[model samples]
Target: MIKILLVGCNGKMGTMISTVAQNSTTLTIAAGFDSKTEGNFNYPVYDSLTNVKENVDVVLDFSRPATLDSICEFVLNRKIPVVFCTTGYSAEQLNKIQGLSAEVPVFHSANMSIGINIVNNILKTISNTLYKDFDIEIIEKHHNQKVDAPSGTALLLANTIKDSIEAETEFNYGREGIAKREHKEIGIHAIRGGNIIGDHEVIFAGKGEVIEIKHSAISREVFAVGALKACEYVYDKTPGMYSMDNVVNDTIKF
Candidate 1:
């Protein structure tokens, strides 16, 4: 059985993952860390990673990027495997995560829904194969509490699509009063609303036709399963950077 230390244990995703862990005989919650947890679970509750023992097989994070440095330090110092499902990291922070991958296994995914990731893969392949035939645009809707615009997942889709297009060029976050769509520019729009779980859509437009591919997540538990899957994937792997793409065992489209 794999033991998990869950970060952000007071949040919705954390609670969902806990329930999932409780149901699975192959997994257990070793400990949880949260700034706002009201009380204890069956296991320990910690407010600081420094106070927590590195006794678990894996650490799963769904917290803010602000907490990343401390978490990375904990993982590196403890030599523990990690699955980071949080979004909103700067490029330098991402590089830092990659840096630690040289010493300990790490998996990070903006979207932890396996089916959504598979859709991203297919979008990459199609964009690469049909660059001239399509004009690409992405729109993502997330919960109101989400801070980032043009969600990490939407960017993942757009970036994957860009990777496939040979002459792929620019990423346009949104359009204004008088803008023209460049053939190479991929458009991304972000929507935040009340109680929305998650929704993503990729539009492929051409002179004569249009195609749209979409994915909607109804529950946070899907991401929990994905995080758990990442734990399983990186358990025996070398210390290196990985994404859900790697966990899903699909070739990088580009």
Candidate 2:
């Protein structure tokens, strides 16, 4: 069994991971790291990773960007693999994460849902085929408690859409007064309210036809399950950086 040191173990996603792992035959929660360690967990929860002594095979991180430094330190020191599922990291932090991969395995993604990664591939094909005839816009929705706008998955999809086309593609966050859509720009809009797990819609507008590709996450369980799959994939791997695309392609799955 793979023993996981779960970061953000007291949050909704953390609890969900624990819940999912309980039914798995090859996974176990070794321990957890969280600021709020008061929750009743099957494994011990510590306020920090500095004092952790668990025999963990891998780490599953869903914590804030603020906790990244300590998480990196722990993984580097222990030479353990890690799956970082948190988004909204600054460019410098992302560089640090890539650097850490040189020493230990690191799996990071903007979003961890398997369906979203499938949608990523779908957008690539659609963008390549529709580039000459369609104008594209992306709309994303998330819970009000979420701090980042444009949800990382939206950016992931936007970048895939941008790179698939031969011509230059620019990103427009949203339209304002007197602003009109440009031929080479992809518009991204964000909406926040209520308890939306997540929602993303990609609209392709053509002369007389419009196509919308959408993915809606009904619950946080999808992300949690994806992270668990990443944990399994990275558990015994060599040092390298990985993404959900690797898991989707069955690179590590037997």
Which clashing pairs does model 2 show? none
| Highest lDDT scorer | 2
Pairs that collide in candidate 1 are 128-164
Q: Which residue ranges in model 2 land beyond 4 Å of their true spot? A: 251-254
TM-score of each: 0.95, 0.97
lDDT of each: 0.86, 0.92
Encode model 1's per-residue lDDT on 94-115: one tens digit a residue.
Answer: 9999898999999888898888
Top candidate on TM-score is: 2
Q: Could you tell me how far off, in angstroms, the CA of residue 52 lies in candidate 1 after the best superposition?
A: 1.1
* Candidate 1 segments exceeding 4 Å error: 250-254
Q: In candidate 1, how many Å is residue 59 off?
A: 0.8
Q: How far is 64's C-alpha from truth in model 2 (Å)?
A: 0.4
Instruction: Provide the RMSD of all predictions against the true structure, rounded to 1 decimal.
Output: 2.0, 1.9
Worst 10-residue lDDT window, candidate 1: 245-254
